[model samples]
Target chain A: MKRDLFIIMFISSILIFPMTVEEIFDKVDENMVYKNMKFTARMNILEYNENRELSMDIFMRDENNILIEILASSSGHTNRFMKKNDQMWLYIPNAGKAIRIKGHMLKEGFMGSDFSYEDMSENRKTNDLYNMELLSKDTLYIIKLTAKSSDAPYKMKMVYIKKDIFIPIREEIYSSSERLLKELIINEYKKIGEKYIPINILMYDKLKQNSRTEIVYEDIKMNAGIDDKYFQKSYFER
Target chain B: MKKIFLFLIIIPYIIFALRFSGEYNYNYYYYQSLNAYGENRVILNMNADKGIASFHLQGLGQFYIGGPKYIIPYPDNIPNYVIDNLPSYYQLSNSMKINTAYLSIYYLGFNLKFGKFPMKWGISQTYAPADIFSSTSPMDYSYIEEGILGFLGMYSFGDNTISFIYQDHTDYEQTKQGLLFENINNYFTASLFSAHFFNTRRIFNGFVFRTNTVEYLLSGFNIITDYWGPGIWIEIDYFADVEYWIQDSIADYSHYFLIAGVDYTFNDLLYTSLEYIYYSEGKTDGFTYNDILRRYLNDNFLISKHYLIPIIGINQGETISGEFAAMINANDLSSMIMTSLIYQPREYLSMDLNSSFVIGNLGKDFYGLPPIYTFQLKFYY
Candidate 1:
C-alpha cells in the first residue's frame, strides 16, 4: 500500500500546469525592469588585439527616460547622453548647449563598441515592442519575439530564458531587414535581493568578423530614489 | 599672471581631487610654401564633487615653435607698412592660459557658478551668430573654447529657465551683463537672450600704447530641434550698436547676423551637414586691406555678406574617421576646403592627419595662402 501511494503522488506532480508565454514573460519583466534604477558599467571594445575601454554611470526613470554620464573615456573629455521618450541628445561638455540627435543615429556603434545606442536604450519590456510566443522548452525556454510596431529597433528576436531563474541567457537579434545582425550571450548571474541580474555580457557583430564587445554591469541598485531634477532639461543644461 | 593660473590649477587638484589628470597634445604643420611649425599643449584637469556643490578646472600651456623665422614681405599691391613695422611673423615662445575654472554651487533650488567657463549660447553648429562671447573656428571640430570669466546665476521652474550673467573686465569701460531665458518642449528647445558687450582697443600713442574700451549692445534668438527627420537649428543676433570701427561701413545701421543649418547621420558610417550664414556687417561691394584690419581687430572675421558651409564625413564610430568640409563665400565664390583623418588605436592614444587649401584669385578672399598639412597626436592620462 505504501509503494502504490508513492507512485500516484509522483505521477500527480508530473501532470502540473505548464507556464504560458504571457505568464513566463510577465515574470521576466518583473525580474528585469524597474521604475527607477542606477548602475555603473564598463565596456571593452576589442579591435586589432587592443582593448579600448569606457566607463559610465547610468540613471533610468521608467523605461523612456535614460541618462548616461561618461566618467572615463578613451577619447579624453567627459560627455553625456539623455534619451527622453523617443528623442535623444548628446550633451558635449563645455560646448554649452545640448544638440538634438535623431533616431537613425541610434544604430551607430556606441563608443566604437558592438553595442549600438539602440542597444543601450532597450530597457523597456518586451511585451510592449514584440509579440512573443513560446517556441520550445527543455533545459531552457526558447521564445520567439516578432516586432509589433514598424518602429521597433529589431525585426525579430530569439530570447532563451533559463527555466529555473526566468532570466535570459542568450538573445539573437535581427535587423529591420531581417538580417542576422548581432548575437548577445549573457553569463554570471548574481542574486540581488529577490532578483537575478546578469553581470557579464558579450555581444558579437555577425556581419563583421572578430568584432565583439564585452560589457560588465556593476553596483546595480534597483528601486532607488533619485532626484526628479536629474531627468529634467535643466539637469543637462546645468 | 602665469603663476596665478598655475596656483589656481594646482591648488584645486590638491584640495578637491586626489588624482591628477591631464592631456598632452603635439601638432606639426607643413605648408606648401615650405614652412613648417609645431604646437605643443599640456592640459591639466580637476574635478571634485561633494553633496550639491562641485568644482571643475582645466588649464592649458601651449608652446608654438618653428614657422617663418622672420616676417614675410608683403606683395607690392598690398599694403606693406604694417608688415614693415612688425618684427616677427609669430610668437616662438609658449604661453599659459586658464581654459576653465568654475565652482558650481546649488542652494535653495537655485544654481550659481563663479569663475571662468564656456558660455554656450548658440544653436548653430559650424557658425553661431548668437554665440557672441567667443569665436568658433571652422576647422575645430573639438570646439576648443576660451571660456569667459563671469558670474552666472540660474533659476529653473517647470520646463523653463532664466539666467543672469555678469562679467567685470579691467580692460573694458563697463561690465558685461547678459540675461537669458530658455524653454524646453517635447520636440524643440528655444532661447532668447539680450547682452551688453564691452571690448578693449589698444591704440598707439607714439610714446606708449593706450587701452580704449568700446561697447556693442546685442539681442538674439535661437532654436534647436529634432522633430523633423534631420536635425535643424537657427540662430539670429541683432546688434543695436555696432562696434565703433564697424560703424564706418554701416554708420548707425542696425547690424544683424543669421545662421541656419541642418545635419543628419546615417547609422555609424556617414554624417553630413550644411549651413547658411548671412551677416549685415559684411560688405557686399568688396573688401580692402583697411577693412580686413578692422574686421580682424573686432573679431568679425567673416568678411562676406553671404556664406555656405557643407561637411561630409565617414566613420567607424570613434575608431577611424574621415571628413571633408568646405566654407564658401558666396559673394566672392572663394572657398576653403579642409579634409581630416583620425585614428584611435588604443584607449588613451589618438592621431589626426589634416589638410586645408584655399581657392581664389590673389586679391580675393582666402587667397595667396598655401595649403597646410597637419599631423597631430594626443595622449591622455
Candidate 2:
C-alpha cells in the first residue's frame, strides 16, 4: 500500500508541474510583446573597502528590440562615448581630442568597472541563447536555461518569474566553472504602457566583496518616435 | 611670437569641429589605505578615471568614436602645450620660465606630428615591458617629459600604419650655457641631450562573422648622453665642478617588446579578450637631482618603480564585467593580481568596485604592496 501511494504521488506531481508552468508562461507572454516604449533607469553601486559609491542612468526602447541608447557618466573628469552598433568614442575635456575606440578595445573596463562595452549594449534575446525547460511552479514559473553559445561566460541560469505579471523575480548568473558570480533580483515592478516591467533591480555578487548595485527608474516613456540618424556611430565622434 | 603662431595654427580646427556623445563608466579601488606604523593615513588611493563623450559632425565630416584622453595634467615644473581656455596648475614664477609648442595633424586616416608631441612605444600592461626603451610609461601620467622635441609621425596603412623614426633631445635644455666666475661653459652645453632610432608597426585585421583581433610589434634604440650632473658651487673656480658624474659611465641601450591581443564578440551584448606581451631589457637613465637631494637630506625615499605586467578582461551585457591584471618582476619578483567588477544603471549614473591581492612568496613581513580596494560613483549627461 505504501509503494502504491508513493507511485500515485509521483505521477500527480509530474502531471501538475507542466500544467502550471505552461499556464504561467502563457500569462507572461501576454504582456511581453514587441512595442515602442521609452524608459529611464537608475542604478547604484556599492564598492568594497572604504571606497565611495557610484550611480548611473539608463535609457531604453524596444523598436523590434533593435536600437538602444546608453549614456553613462564616463568618469568624474571626462564626458564621452555616444555611439551605436558596438562602436564607441570618448571625448576628454583636457586633451581636447575625441578618441575613437575600435574592435576589442571597446570590451575594456568602463572606468574600471565590471561593465564592458558589451554590457552597456542592446542585447535582449533569451530564447536565442538558451535552451529553456520548465522546471516547476511555485508562486511563479520557474525555468532552467542552458546556454547554447559555447563561448558564453555563464554555463547555466535558473530564472524565477511571477505567474500573474509574467515578469522575472530573480536570476542567478554562473561562471563556466559553475561558481555563482552574481545574482540579480527585481525588487519592485511598475505598470507602464499597459505592461508590467521591472522598475527597480538589485545585483549582488557571491564574492565576499562589499559591492552591490541598485537600479531605480524614475521617469519612463514608451513608443515615442526617435530618429534613426541619432543612433549612428558617426554621432559618437561628432 | 611663437605663442601667437600656435594659436593661429592649432586653435582654428578644434574650435570648428562639433560633436555629441555619452558613456557608462566605473572605477574600482578609488581609495585604499596603507597599513603603517602611525595612524594609517590615505597613503595612496585607487585612482580610477572613466568617462564617455559623443560628438556630432552636423554634416561636417566623417564620424569617429572611441575612448577620450583620460589623463592630461597641467604644466608646473614640467613643460608642454597649454590649452588657453582650460585650467592650469602652474604659473610662471620669478625664478623660472617655460615655453613649448607641437604641431599635430590627424587627417586622411593618419595621425602625423612634427616638433614636440606625446608618442608611446613599448609593450607593457603594468610597467612597460620595454621599460628601458619605451619613452612613455604608465607612471608618467602628467605626459610632461615623454613628448620628445623632434619630428614624429604615424600613418595608418590600410587601416593601420607601421614605421621607423629617429629623433634627438628627450628633454628641452637651455640653449645658452651658464658661466662661473664670469667665464665658463655656455648654457646650451649644460642642457639635457638624448638620441634614438625607433621602429614600430601594428596591424589590425580579422573582422569576419563578428570576431576581431589585432597584433602589434615595437622595436627601438635609445641613447642618452650629456645628462645633468651635480656640481659644486665654485666661487673662485672658472668651471662648474662636475662632482656626481653620470655621463662617463652611461651606456647606450637597445630594447624591444611585442604585444598581441584579440577581441571576440559572441553576440551584440557579450565580448571577451585575451592578450600576451614579451619584453627585452636595456639600460636606464640617471637619477633626478631630487633623488640625490633626498639621499643627502634624508636616507629614505622611492627612487623609481619599474616592472612588467600582464592584463586580462571580460564583459557580459551592459551591467556586469570582470578584469584581472598582474604585474611581476622580469624574473623573480612575486606577482600582483588585481580584479574588479562594475555596474551601471543608466547613462547618467554608474558604480565600480575592485580588489587586489598578492600571489606567491613576497619577502618581508608585509608586502610593500597593499591589497587594493576601491569604489567610484559617476555622474555624466
In order, what DockQ does each candidate have?
0.31, 0.03
Candidate number of the best TM-score? 1
Model 2: residues with Cα > 4 Å off, grouped in runs: A1-38, A48-122, A151-153, A228-230, B1-381
Per-residue lDDT value at B19 in model 1: 32
What local distance difference test score does each model get?
Answer: 0.73, 0.40
- The lowest-lDDT stretch of 10 consecutive residues in candidate 2 chain B is B38-47
TM-score of each: 0.82, 0.40
Please give the lDDT score for candidate 1.
0.73
- Displacement of the residue A20 alpha carbon in candidate 1, Å: 8.1
DockQ of 2: 0.03
lDDT of 1 by residue, B66-95 (tens): 762323323225444554543435335667
The weakest ten consecutive residues by lDDT in model 2 chain A span A229-238
**Which residue pairs clash in candidate 1?**
none
